[model samples]
Target chain A: MAFVLELNGLTKHYGNIQALRQVSLEIPQGTVYGILGPNGSGKTTMLGLIMNILQPTGGSIRLFGEAPRADHRQKIGTLLETPNFYHYMNAVQNLQIAAAIKGVTNPDIDGVLEKVNLLQRKNSAFQTYSLGMKQRLAIASCLLGDPQVMVFDEPTNGLDPVGIAEIRDLIRRLAADGKTIIMASHLLDEVEKVCSHVAILKKGVLIAAGHVDEILAQDDLVEVSAANTPQLPELLKALPHCKQITAGDAGKWLLHFEQGTADLRSVNEYSFQQGIVLDHLLLKRRSLESKFIELTN
Target chain B: MNLNIPHLLRIEWMKVKNYKAFWILMILFVVSMIGINYIYWYVKQQFVASGDIAAQAAGSMIFGDFRFPAVFKTVSQMSSWLLYFPGFIVIFHTTNEFTFRTHRQNIIDGLMRKQFVVAKLAGAFLLALVCTLLILLTSLVFGLISGDGYFSLEGLQYIGFFFVQSCVYILFAFTLALLVRRAALAVGIFFIYGLIFDYLLAVWISRGTETTLGYYLMPLQVADELNPPLAELKKVIGSTNQWIALGISIAWLAFYCFFPIRKFEREDL
Candidate 1:
């Protein structure tokens, strides 16, 4: 697969603080790649380094198969941290500045603003914009130059639920149009919903990185409850697909099966053949949120 | 780094185009320049009308034999007091980029760090150019209205020197904004340094050297000397002092340009 971005041993130090430590990952083209971490887990610092806003103490970054350069940056749109704009200028004026910087002579500023639903207020001063409007304007600014890659740091931050959903839909549409999106977000559910691939970071270290399904698809959990819960663990232990079984609350036992091996019928049949009756046998698919908590903690 | 001048200038223009404060400050500077020059002309006329010998002598020094070149010198000098207004404008312009975090956003928008510095410098140059042009236009109109014949235009080099002087002050303000990175703090330091610190330092150094050359060579002083107060005061600085002042001013300009670029190149934001 062609990689849109690649990092090798990327490290950053802010005086005594090591913001990023030897982080290395590759983002494949046309994938919604997410850099997930809690606040101050170096998500913003990493994005700043890659965008050349902050100097990396150590590392190399390659975009589009070459070293990062000014021209390379032109092909990538970015919104880091907050919507930074001239408060005295209106939305259209602010986007025009971005268009000029990006070297787009006939920039469809209105099209992008309409996409973000800020076209109506394009002439209003930025200071007069609400928080949501400011955020939408930031997104609109990033859509200039028809860039192939979009880098957003907490894109949906400070938005109402409706605004968040609208932005999420916009991101999905962009990705559908074959744009490679690299977003840094602390919202686990948002990342899980929108990102096709994820890299989880904890304390400046990469804890997990892979396809979302693969990373969250380690095993299917089966919660089986019976009248004799004490005897359930012994029965589950005999099954080859059941890797582990642990007691749960109120005469319930949880069974872990290897990926793609667990099925309700199989577990039921095994219990029936063992002459043990089963009351509850539900397959619990692992969620990204739970996996994230498991890895980060 | 490939530096595209037009592209950089366009970027800078986009920043200031819709900025109300920028226009307000510019209008204030222009209005103050015109208002103060008119007041100075009226006072000079009153001096000429007075019958006292000292008042007549002072009046003649300024207005009695006013040639077009002397008009240029008088008008440009009268306008120089308002340089701090443009200086404040430059300061606010530079600091606004940082205050709004647009400096960082601009980089993310694909501007190289060097380009950001170059664009700001270009903006400063443009402001200085506008100020110089206003001085030229004002002086030309005033000179034509107040004096006779194009023969008064003989000392037009003073106007060119005025342009250079405006650039020096604007770049000095730009350098301060780059170094301080805070609008109020940079403006404060600029005023204190230009009004108090440089004056005291010049006086202290001149006292020790027993020569006023030391005073004239200070950064602001050298630029101020470029368009001396009166036509006769031009002779106070010999040809050698003029050359020294020109050399020092150029050196200061070079520092103001390069030092900020170097510092900005290494800065994280």
Candidate 2:
């Protein structure tokens, strides 16, 4: 797979404190990659280093198969931390400045504002914009150059539910158009709904990284209850595919299957062969939130 | 790396285009330049017509045969007081970027750190140019209306010196803004250093050394000596002193430009 961004043991230190400790990641092209971490987990630091805003204390980063530089950054769009802009200037004016910095003479500022739903207020001063409007305008600024890769640190921050939904839809549409997106978010559900791949970070360390499906696979939890509830635990322990059997609420026993075990019918047939009639059998898919908590802790 | 001058200038212009305070400061600077020069001309004209020997001597001494070079020198020197306005404008321009956090945004938008420095330098260069033109126009108009048409190109060197001095002041303000990165603090330090601190230190040092060289070597003092007051224009700065002051002023300007670039290049936003 082609990687749009590659980091090799990237690290950062602020004075005596280490912000990022040898973080290494490779974001494949055409994938919506999410960097999941709570506050102060070095998510912004990582993004800032890759965007060349902060100098890395150690290691290296490559963009589009070469060392990242100012010129190479032209192909990537970034919105770091907050929506920073000249509050005295309006949306169009600010975007024009951004366009000029990107070496774009005739950027479609109107089209970008329209995409972010800020076209009607394009001429209003930025100071007059609400928090949500300011955020949307920041997104519009990032979209000015039609970059191949988009790096957003908390892209949905400060937006209302409707605004958040709109931004989520926009991210999906951009990813559908083959744009690689790297979003740093503390919102677990947001990542679960939007990301194709995820890397969980805790305390400046990478805890887990993989495709979303592989990281939080479907039907990892199976709850089974039968008339012989007392015997269910023993039978579950004897099954070769069952990784762990624990007593659950309401006289049901929870079964955790080993990796790649997705056969519910076999478990049911084994129970019947053992002369045990099962009254209830249900499969529970583990959520990304629980998986994230498990890995971070 | 090849710096795209035009594109960077466009970026700089976009920053200040709709800024109300920027325009207000610029307008006040220009109007003050014209208004003050006109008032001086009116007072000089009245003195010249008084027919009193003392008043006439004072008038001629102040206005000097209003010709090509002297006119340029006198008008340019008169407008020198207005440099602080533009200096404040430069301060505002630089600090506003920090206030708005647009300096960091500019880098994220693909501007090299050095390019951001270059853009501000380019903007300062343009401001200096406009200031020089205003000085020249103000001198030309007042010279024609007031003096006995004894036009000559002999004193035009003062205009060049004035332009250089304007640039030095603007760059000095830019350096302060970059160092402080806060509008009020930078402006405060700029005024305190230029108005009170530098002068006081220069005076104390000059008295101890028994030579004004120490005073003349200071940044603002060097620039100020380049365009001496009309009364002591020739006596205060000799040709040798002029060369020394020019070299020192240029050195300070260079420091102001490069030092900020160095600082911004290494600092984290």
In the order shown, the candidates' DockQ scores are 0.80, 0.71
**Clashing residue pairs, candidate 1?**
B68-B152
Once fitted onto the true fold, the runs of candidate 1 whose alpha carbons sit more than 4 angstroms away are A225-234, A247-252, A258-261, A264-269, A272-285, B60-66, B148-150, B213-217, B230-240
For every model in order, the TM-score on chain A comes to 0.93, 0.90
Model 2: per-residue Cα lDDT at residue B106: 87
Candidate 1: C-alpha lDDT = 0.85
Query: Best candidate per DockQ, number?
Result: 1
TM-score of 2: 0.92
**Poorest stretch of ten by lDDT in candidate 1 chain B:** B231-240
The digit string of per-residue lDDT tens for model 1 on B1-269 reads 68997889987888777777889999999999888887877777687668788996777566433347677778888888899999998899999999999999888888989999988888888888899899888888777766656646676776777777888899999988988889999999999899888868876777787777655668887887776666555446332255566667888888888999999889799
True contacts kept of 1: 0.91
